[model samples]
Target: MFEWPWKDIARECELYLGPAGFSAVQVSPPHEHIVWEKHPWWERYQVASYKIESRSGNEAEFADMVKRCRRAGVDIYADAVINHMTGIPGGTAVGGTSFTHYDYPGIYDFNDFHHCGRNGNDDIVNYKDLYELQNCELVDLADLATETSKVQNTIAAYLNHLLDLGVAGFRIDAAKHIPAKDLKAIMSQLKRSAYVYQEVIYDPAGPISYADYTPIGDVTAYDYAHRLGAAIKDKKMDGLLHIGENFPASNDSIVFVTNHDLERTGDPYILKYSSEDQKLYRLAQIFMLAWPFGYPQVYTGYDFTNYDDGPPLNEQLRTLPVLSSQNQCTAPFTCEHRLPEVAAMVDFRNQTDGSFVVNNFWSNNTDQLAFSRGQKGFVAINFSGNQLPKEFQTGLPAGKYCNIVGASYNPNTHSCPNMIEVNAQGKANVVIQAYSAMVLLNRTTASQKKKAL
Candidate 1:
């Protein structure tokens, strides 16, 4: 969640994240990388060596974190930038490894990289050219020759190192640039089968198709965020009640509202947890979590006023620790997952596992929507202004239900700090505020005294 080292994250696993019901934590790239003057986050994406040494922490610390999170029942998903090498010609890595472009000491040699610059070509100008896009350099990063046995061995060995360290999976950076067959080949050689998600940016008209990658692992549904955010931004939520409506299959997709890339790459349709859009962004998150769509990933990172700005750092280039504000998240960090409602929603998902949306209802104006996941849970969302007072089929057993979004379920009291009563007819007279949502969990009587305070 927070942009901190593995050690810092380990300390909070049991106390903060584990209790919140997080399945995994996707960390920044841990490979040794070309160190820049300011140590930008993208620089971590540029590889120097497979050594588990970088700005985040050393080998021992990384190992300790994996062990700690496992005990807490949270897996670590390391961001593996195996697509290319550093864009620079020569530089020293943050871990003290020294190397130049396409030449890492004791690893790859010059021939291991693709010299795609035919006419001194250094950039990708033809988005329509399939061969150029796959074989050529992306933003000048030296493309690896993954088809060769030597390159495949080195890549697999690197990932095996992480698997040996207890990493649960990998987020293959720039996965679209690598052929699916080559990727599958590398993964097949891992020490053990590991969960894998490829960073394949979706472009429907682009040469690369997600079909090639889904057989391997989940593909990033960038289109999900782009399209969903657009719908919510335009105050249209009725059409999105159906999960996987405009996205890849539920099991093959990984959905998110914003990530490191989208926050900086300004697109009006996409969203960031900004002052004006924070509420709306949270609504999108609710929809994602409530709906039975692809695996959902909630992003919580550094707050940046400038698109190029990296996480808060000291003069020594070390990341500053993030603190909680007792509200939704801490300052300078969009800790959306830490919000009481969001955390409760994580539990909401777990309680209603194997459930599908039923008893679906959409308002006449289409701005208000309600649905049930099986008979265990119900959710109502109001996207328009003013209070919305309407009765809808909840599909849940009748009781004094707690609004997980607005209140907390106090187990000791066996009552909600804030309660919304539902009748035996499976109806709730829900009145949600503008751009707000309510979630009801019948598995247990939710109460605000336990969490909503």
Candidate 2:
């Protein structure tokens, strides 16, 4: 979730993008946080109270954004940061909520935290070491002992309040830091009201497996991002064919190229560490969106020279507004989510919902990748700096259909660079540009006719 003034930006999103097919807008934490004079935006993750009084907006404004977004057929998913609280010095939250090092009268005092000196330093590592992760400080942020009934109820109340306000789900932050059982308890309390997506950065060598958090909710597939990033850089389209084959088909995973923490820490996967690397990063994102794997999240970021630099904000310490025009963003704001290729994939994914990826996959072993989605949608990618001319099975009922990638008619005509038409024989002679992707929609499906009716 990108943190901005929701009251102002949410409406624009609802009007322009929401109804077009966006199911939800993942909002940053609505909870109160510790405001720092030097880095006020750091408070976004350093939660103080569950009260809805932060930079995004007040409780009323939040409710309005929810109602408006829901009215536009868009749901809201909140980024729930329950792992720790304020760690910076002399930073009080905007809602008048305050917490000192290891001391929070409203929540829990700091001494209650664990101080195990392990990894050659005092830090939490795993569930078996629950006391340290839950109670000990996370990078100096006041950790909360979620195992306590009081803390559980407090957090539950906060989550339930959002549910009552119409939020559809949550992305649990620092989930691996908490015990699995404690997370299960918290989720059990949440019940069916909000969908939970846990953040457990996968490290196979580590004690925690994704299964630990799966019982509570969907776990993020960090490995997927790593693999996709590598394959794209290598220009190994055959490797792209292997995408999503690694994860169990039964589990729901949150797939993302870059996130708040990754972008904040200057994760090399994004920000064009090199020109070639930047193109590969964009290609990986396109591939991720095209493939039928996990619940995908698109990242919208801002330009930054330093890892610690925050979102573009005004002198008042509020985040700047987002610009909605195509290929243009507010200065310093990089709205990759609105890019033509990225936005096109959103439509392609939504249109092919409930479709499975068919197996007759093919790739040039270097720069071209092609596959069909359960006879419903077909896609081809070309990245070899040469036009791809190939005939592939589309699995569609014979009819002339507009290629969704090249010429989608929804937003407007000539909106995209390439447009191909598939004939009645379910065959397409695709000629794709070196750095582009093409997707074809099966036009004669029963669902399509039913929708037409």
Candidate 3:
């Protein structure tokens, strides 16, 4: 639910994403920030105050949304923007709070922020210098002195407030710019344990490394996206056999196909959410969900022509409702998670949670690939232009399983619109169409339902 307002996210969790088997959602930064006239999306990342108010919602609305979403079995992981303050020198925040450089009223003062006098303007100009990168400003944003006790306490208090409101975790934004020691100090100040994942974009040449943060919590494995995007674009499915290699440990990585940033970059290395590349992008998501890799997250955000353009906003610049009419996500909202194929695969991932071993792996040496999750589930992807018609070892118990990706399966009614039959030898001869996928789950194994021809 990228860039979705708090209230809309709450409604969708109870109505759709929760029932659809989604575990958690990474939401936009809940902290107050500069309310630029243009209302660009990146403005949300530039924090003004610790108060939980923004284009998303006010404090009361955010609290209620968190409570409702948690009750629906969906946890809320807020994107905590503790790395820096407002990029602008002085401005009124979204909550109407006034603040100037290093002088947030009742929050931070001049001494609280870092004045790393390295570059002429104290801005981060050298990525190779770890000290300047950590202490200096990022894109003219006021860098917090996270190492000091006062600053760490203030940051911890803000996070503790969210935790009190039932937040499940935090996505430490700009984590690469903050020293690992400073982050650990802030985490220690928290009253209780919460899931923490850092945004340490993998950079082998840089002074700081993803490994530095792995000891603290899971780090984003951006290389996975780079490798995956390039492979999919090249129609080289076989190369993905070693997808997670040379990255963070599987248990300590958070992975996704395309996030808000990558989707807007127009980067050919990874697929974006667009009409022209929707098929391949969807196919890549299917593979990511099925394959045993890092903890997977399905990104669903609004479509934007300009990178700076924010989500659909009302006259007041507040985010509009996600869906348009008839509960269907229309223009501006890509709603990738709501897609039947992606939703079914969420169930696929959940059902095959413990089946980490990737067995019965088969590939056409080109664009077609099939693999099984230790008899729990099997997925076959056909990326080529031609329909892939062949028999493959599925490694599931012999039975008629529903093709959950293409159709629906009602367990109570024992109805599956589309079915794939497996013989006693645990193999199914299936024809997967071009740019489509076939997913079979043990839970979807239908015995009483009449088999499809």
Candidate 4:
């Protein structure tokens, strides 16, 4: 969600994208934050209090947005930043809430935090680095002492409020910094109203294991994002096959191409590195959405030359409106989610309902990758330099079907930009273009086993 009030935006989202299958909208942090006149946009991550008042909107507007989104069958997920509070000192938040370092009378003070500093670094001196990360300052921000009963109550109350508002889940920012035990405590306190996903960027070899966060909720599969991006950039089609193969079978993860923080912090490894390779980047996203492993998050970004620059804003510093009427993005927005192939993948995932990836996977070892979602749906991707001939195993019921990824289907003639007629043997001869993806659904008939010969 943007910084502006969500009433109108949520309403419009429901109007346009809702029909296109957007079941959820992840809003920015809804807490109050210390607003700096010089860099107002930085206020997003800096938390002052758990109150539902900030650049996004006030309490009433937030409630209204939730109601409207839920009414449209879309759920709201909050970006919960419980790791730290505002970094600036001697200043009230935009909501006029006052706070001080080592002395938060309204909540708790620094003494209430877990203090264990090897050096005299007041910034974070405590739970053996883990405690400080959770209870001390993060980038000079006032860290919440989640270990304390008072702090836990406050955080729990705030989360409960959002849950009561009918949010679907949460995205815990900087979760790797926070201790797993404290996170479990916080999770135990909540009324189980929403799902909790922690941000643990685990590489191939990391100090922390994803299993730590799995006890609480799903951990972000940051490695998957990096690997996918790398494969796309190198044009290493074979490397792309290794995607999701590395993910631990036991733990669930949230996979995404990019997020607000990564895009803002200029993570060269992901987007910046793949800047010159747009086709590959898009193909990586397609494969991610096609393969069933973790919960997939599709990013809709605004084009920016500078990484630190905020979303398209007006002179007043408020986020400018996003135009989705033309099925295209304008005014510096990189609406990758609107692409026909990407949108089709979302639809495919929704239709698959997290089924196992059928092992009958086929790849040309060059550009084409095809797989079936058990018997529900079939997908073929063409990433080669040239168009592919009409040939592939779709694993669908024997019948004629329309390609949902191409042009919209006309109910009258049932004509679409792409069509396939599956033979009695449950195979489809699919032709796809370079840098394109095709998905076919067996909406007409169910996949039944062949009779014993």
- Report, for all candidates in order, the number of backbone clashes: 8, 5, 0, 3
Candidate 3 ranges with C-alpha deviation above 4 Å? 324-326, 408-414, 444-453
Candidate maximizing TM-score: 3
Q: On a 0 to 1 TM-score scale, where does candidate 3 land against the true structure?
A: 0.95
* Per-residue lDDT over 1-453 for candidate 3, one digit per residue giving the tens place of the 0 to 100 score: 888889888988888877877888888999988888678999899888888888888899999999998898888999999988887878888788998878998888989889998779999887888998899999889999999999999999999999999998999999999999999999998898998999987667888988789888888887788788787778677789999988888888888887878777757787776757788889888899888888887888887778799877787668888765567676788787877787777777777876777998888777889999887889998887899999989999998888877756663343587788999999999888888888888864422211000
Best of the two (1, 4) by TM-score? 1
Better of 2 and 4 by TM-score: 2
Which number leads on lDDT? Answer: 3
| Model 4 spans with C-alpha error above 4 angstroms | 2-5, 37-41, 114-136, 203-206, 248-251, 265-276, 312-317, 323-330, 408-418, 445-453
* Model 2 misplaced regions, further than 4 Å: 117-121, 125-135, 245-251, 264-279, 324-328, 407-425, 446-453
Greater lDDT among 1 and 2 belongs to: 1
The alpha-carbon deviation from the true structure for residue 448 of candidate 3, after best TM-score superposition, in angstroms, is 24
- lDDT per residue for candidate 1 within 1-453, as digits (tens), equals 535667767866766777777888888888887767656668778899999887677889889999998898788999999989889988878777889887887999999987776537656667667777778888888899888889999999999999999999999999988888999899889988888998988677888888889989988888788777766766566557543665568777888888888877768877878657787788877877877777789887877776556677666555665654332344676566666677777777767765744566665434667788867889888766768788878887888877877745653243576688889988888678877888888865332211100
**Can you give the TM-score per candidate against the true fold?**
0.93, 0.88, 0.95, 0.86
For residues 390-426, could you state the per-residue lDDT of candidate 2 as single tens digits?
Answer: 8877766565555555534454542334445566777
Model 1: runs farther than 4 Å from truth? 323-331, 364-366, 408-414, 444-453
lDDT, candidate 4, 1-453, per-residue tens: 444346544764566445556667777888887667654456788877778887667788888888887787677889898877767765777678887755555766766555445346546544244444455566676666676777778788889899987777888988877778878888788887577888886644554677778888877877776676666555566776567775655237777777766656644547531267577667767777777677787776566665455565456444566655553446666666666666566656666764556645877665677788877888787777788876667777787788766657543354586567889888776668777777777655333221000
The lDDT of each candidate is 0.77, 0.68, 0.83, 0.68
Clashing pairs for model 3 are none
Alpha carbon lDDT at 78, candidate 2: 89
